[model samples]
Target: MKDLIILWLSGGNDAWWSVLVAMGNPWQVLDLGAVLALIVVGMQIAVATCLPDRLWADDGTNAFFSQLSYLHIFLLMALTALAEEIFFRAAIQSLLVEWLHSVAAGIAVPAAIFAVAQRARPASCASASRAAPATASSWG
Candidate 1:
């Protein structure tokens, strides 16, 4: 994580805490993150409820989620988010940036890999929601 942050910042000087304390203010960063999270959650809720059924037709993905208790769902979502960030952002993307010497390549390569991975997953595996934020972060 520290190496990734140093590579990302391009200074090779920022400590690992820079990842946790963005812009030198952890509280402000957390507040902003919370707002963004709420917006994403609200958008998801709106999509699930307001979109036509045909838009989200019951594939095994729906069935997969429906079987899980709320606790399990939340835990899976948290774990998925953590793992994706660590792998896609901290590891793969960092290496791509260093190797390719291009930030755009760094972002696009992992996103393409992520899309491919998502497509390759079994129907009863992870949900598309788990990929949304990772994709967004890559392009954002």
Candidate 2:
């Protein structure tokens, strides 16, 4: 478990280091896709929180659709999807296979580690709720 966590963190650090060296600096590049992704994510959250009841209304659709015309959104989404897949599915999985030196071991180790990492938030949320006793007023 410790080894897997270490590997994951180190891999991320290494990736960032390499990216910095190769790209000279990420901020300098006009990453339209990232900007678009951020705008989309922010808008989604804003709509969900501020206008939850009307999110699916015609006006909401119009507002959301307008963002789609921005070229940066498409670029950001494509780059993000590609980068995530390569990092997690290819690079991390391949490294795990190399370290474990067995197909089953490699797959199992990384998969288990990945599952645990991914589920940490939900698991913690569940545990926290369970730990808190239900109150009559809250339930009502």
Candidate 3:
């Protein structure tokens, strides 16, 4: 997906690309990804039924989705979760753990960062990931 790369990388080969492209145990990745997808999808449905989109989302976000078919939206949401997991858990939070030499500080810093970042607007449904619950807070 061309759009996935652009959205994830924003047109540059920063260290983030290395983070996104790294490989892991096949079964492990599949299992975790599936769990994350399920969580996000469930959260998406809840948000749609419970909250007005205008409360959490902006017109630009609505316009972006308006251009896509249902299948595209589904795929976008799935990819968004995966990409976010890689960025927050696999990279930022892990790095924080090592640098801060404290697991609490590690997860805490990134969790706060994630909450702030998603404050930009209602992000694609929910950023659900069991391994990284902090990012999932946006799972409104």
What TM-score against the true fold does each predicted structure earn?
Answer: 0.57, 0.33, 0.47
The residue pairs that clash in candidate 3, if any, are none
lDDT of 1 at 35: 79
Ranking 2 against 3 by lDDT, winner: 3
Error of 1 at 84 (Å): 1.4
lDDT computed for candidate 2: 0.63
Better of 1 and 3 by lDDT: 1
Badly placed stretches (over 4 Å) of model 3 are: 1-60, 121-140
User: What is the clash count of model 3?
Assistant: 0
Better of 1 and 3 by TM-score: 1
lDDT of each residue in 12-107, candidate 2, tens digit only:
645333443465555734463477679999998987788744233332345766777668678877898798678766887889888877766766
Error of 3 at 55 (Å): 7.9
> Model 3, 46: alpha-carbon shift in Å?
5.9
Q: What's the CA RMSD for each of the models?
A: 11.0, 16.0, 15.5
Which is the winner by TM-score between candidate 2 and candidate 3? Answer: 3
In candidate 1, where is summed lDDT lowest over 10 consecutive residues? 131-140
